[model samples]
Target: MSDVVKPAVPPPATPARALLPLVLPALVIGLGSSLLLAAVSEAAELFKDVLWETLPDAIGIGRWSVGWIMAVLTATGIAVGLVVWKAPGHAGPDPATTGLVDAPLSPRVVPGLLLATGLALAGGVSLGPENPITAANIALAYWLGRRLVPGSSGQVWAALGAAGTVGALFGTPVAAALILTESLAAAPRPQNPAERTPSLWDQLFAPLVAAGAGGVTSKLLGVPSFGLSLPAFDGPRWPDLLAALLVAPVAAVLGLAAVYAFPYVHRAFRMLPHPVLALTLGGVVLGLLGALGGHLTLFKGLDEIGELAADPKGHSAGALVMMTVVKLAAVLVACGSGFRGGRIFPSVFAGAAFGLAVHALVPAVEPSVAVTCGVLGLLLAVTRQGWLSLFTAAVIAPGIGLLPLLCLALLPAWLLVTGRPQMQLDESGAALR
Candidate 1:
C-alpha cells in the first residue's frame, strides 16, 4: 500500500454529545416556559378565589351550603364532560395511574384543556388543575420548540417540554430535571445508546434556566411558592422515632391495600354507560362522604390547610379520623371513576388527617409534629420521592422543629412501600389493554 492514505475522519458527534449544543438553548426555553406556567397557575388561582367569592351570589345561595355545593358539583361534571369530549387528550387521566410523568400534548388541544380545567376548578370539584396546567405547559413548549427547531427529534423536544413544565410547576429546577428524566424513561425513542444519554451538564443547566424563569415569573405574577422553612424541633426523641417505626408498617399496609382496592373500584365504576354517568355516581359518593365528614372532605383541599393550621382543636379528633377515611375513599373513587385530577393534594390531606389522628392517639408527640411527619411519610410512600416528601413535611408543618423527626419517619415508610405493586395502566384513558 505504497500510496499515501488520508487520515480517517472521526464520526460526527452522537445525538447525545450533540446535546451540548442544544443545552443552553433548551435551558433558555425551559426558563421561559417555567415563567409562563407560573403565570398560568397564578392566574388560575386568582380566578378560582374570585369565583369562590362570587359563586354563592351567582347561584343565589350560601357559601358551602348543601344546595350551592351540589350545584357546583353538577356544573363540574358537565364541564368535565365537555372538555373530555372536545379535547380528549387534554383531560389528563388519573395521576395514580399515570404516576408523575409528563405526557405529550398537541397544541390544538391546549386551549380546550385549559378551559376545562379552569371551569372544573371554578365549579368546585375535589380536584386540582395543576396536572392539566403542567400538561398544557408541556404541550406549548413542544409546539414552540418544533416550530423553532425544525430538524430536532420529537423525543428531544418532548423532553424539553416536560422539563419546562416541571420547572414551572415545582419551582425546583433540580426536581424538575429528575422528573423529566424519570418520565422519559418509558417514552418511545430511537434505539441507539449513543443517542440516549443526554449530558449531565446540559441536564443541570437546563433546569437551572427553567428554575430562574419560574422564580421570576412567580414574583411577577404575585404567586406564592412558600419555601421550606418549618420551625426547629426540640430534637428527635426516641418516642418520635419509635412512633415513626410503628407508623411505617401501618402505612405500608394501608398503601398496599389502596393499590389493590383502586382497580376493583375503577372496574366497577367503568360499568357505567358514559363518563358523565360514572362521574355523577362519583359526585354522589363524594357528596355522601362530605355530608358524613363535613366540608373538609369536599374540595381539592388546598384551602383547608390554612384552616387545619389555624385551629386544629376546632376539629374533633373523631372528626379527623372520619374525614381521613372519607377523603381516601373519595379520592379513590374520583381517580378510579375517570375524573380528571391529581391525587397529590388529596393524598396530603389524607396523610395530614391520618397523622393528626395518630397524634391524638399517642398524645406523646406534638400533634403538629406528628401531623407533619405523617404528611411527609404518607406522601413519600405514595409518590416515591423522598426529598419532595421531606420538603412538604417541612413546609406544611407549623414549625421546623419536626424536620429531623419527619426525616427519621420517612425511611421506614419508604422501606415499607418499596417493591410493592403500583397502579397499572395500558395507556392514557384506555381500558387495561
Candidate 2:
C-alpha cells in the first residue's frame, strides 16, 4: 500500500433488480401527487365560482365590473396575507424567490401552502398551481416515504414527487420525463474510476414510472389537457420559418424585460411594513390592471388561453396587446407580494395573447405557427427551461409538421435568453445574474 492508497473497487452499476423494488413506492407517490393536485384544483375552482359568479350574482352586481374586480382582489390579498403571516410555516417561502421545484418543505408547512394557493387561485391571481403543488407534494412524499421505504434518501422522494406533480400539471409524462432528465443529466457524477456509472435511463427509471402513473391518474380524473385544439399547421414554408424567427425572439425580449424587472418589483413590495399591506396593495394594483385588461386577463391562463385560441380574431390587436401587458404586470405583482403560485401558466396565457396580436396585425402568418412560437419564446425567457419550453410549445400546437420549425425557432430565442437574469431571485434578494 503506497502513501496514496487507492480507493476500494466500487460495485457494478445499479442492477435492474435493485430498482424493481422501487416501482410500487414510485407508483404510490405518483398517484398521491396527482390526487393532491386534483383536490387543490377542484377546491379552488369551487371557491372561484363562488367569488366571481355566485356571490356577485347574488349581490346583484356585474361580476366583471371594475368595482367588483377590485374589491374581490383586494379582499383576497388581505386574506392570503393573513395566512402567510400567521399560518404555520408561513406558506413555505416568498413566491418571488422560488422556482417551479425546490428542496422539500416541512410537513407542517403543507397545509398553509395549500390554503394560500387555493385562495390565490380563486382570487384570480396571475399565477399557476405548479410551484406550491410541487413543493407540497415533495414534502408529503418525503414525510410518507421515510415510513414506506426506511432506507431511501430524501432526494429519491423529492424526484418522485416532482416527476409526479409535473406530469399531473401538464397532463403528460413527457413533460415530467424531459424535466427530470434534464435535471438528472446536470447532477454531478461519481469520480471513482472503479465505480460503474449508471446509464441515464437507469437513473430515470423510477421517476419516469412515477410520472407515467401521475399522468394517467390525472387523465382518469378528467383533468383538461394542455393541447389547444388549433387548426393544423399546413407544413412549414420559408415564410412560416421567417414568421417564427421574427416572432420568437421578439417574445423572448418581452419576457426578458419582465425577468429583469422581477427583483426590483419584489423589492418594492418588501418595502411595505407588513405582508398584509404589501399583498393588499398588490391586489389593488392588479384590480386596476384587470379592470383595464378585462376578464380575459384574469386568473391563471389555461382556460383563457383556450378561450383566446377558440376565437383568435374576436379581440382587436390593441385589446390583445393590452391583455398581454396587463397579465405580465399582474403576474409580477402577485408573485412579488408573497402570493404563493407559479408563473408558467400566466406566461403561457400572455404568450397566446401576444401571438394572436401579432397574427391580428399580420394575417399572412399562420395562426398555429405564430401562437406556438410565441409560447416558445416567452417560456424560454421566463422559465429558462429549454426542454419544457419546447415541449409546451409543441403540445399547444400538436403537429409533427411544426416540430422542425419549432426546433429552429427555439435557436435564436434561446440565444437571446441565455446567460440573462432568470425570473428567480437568489439568497441576496436579487435576481440570479
Please name the candidate that would achieve the greatest lDDT relative to the true structure: 2
lDDT of each: 0.63, 0.90
User: What's the TM-score of every candidate structure?
Assistant: 0.81, 0.96
Model 2 per-residue lDDT tens digits across residues 1-433: 5598779664457877899988998999899999999999999999999999999999999999999999999999999999999999998888887888799899999999999999999998899999999999999998898877788798889999999999889888899889987887778777976566567677788988898889999999987667786777878899999999989999999999999888889999999999999999988988998999998898888898999998878999999999989999999989998889999999999888899999999999888988999999999999999999999999998588999999999999999999999999986778875
TM-score of 1: 0.81
Candidate 1 deviant stretches above 4 angstroms: 1-51, 58-60, 88-97, 177-199, 226-232, 397-404, 428-433
lDDT of 1 by residue, 267-348 (tens): 7777887777777766666666666766777767666655665555667678787877777787777677666666667667
lDDT accuracy of residue 33 in candidate 1: 67
Model 1 poorest 10 in a row by lDDT: 223-232
Clashes of each: 7, 0
Candidate 1: count of backbone clashes, pairs at least 3 residues apart or interchain = 7
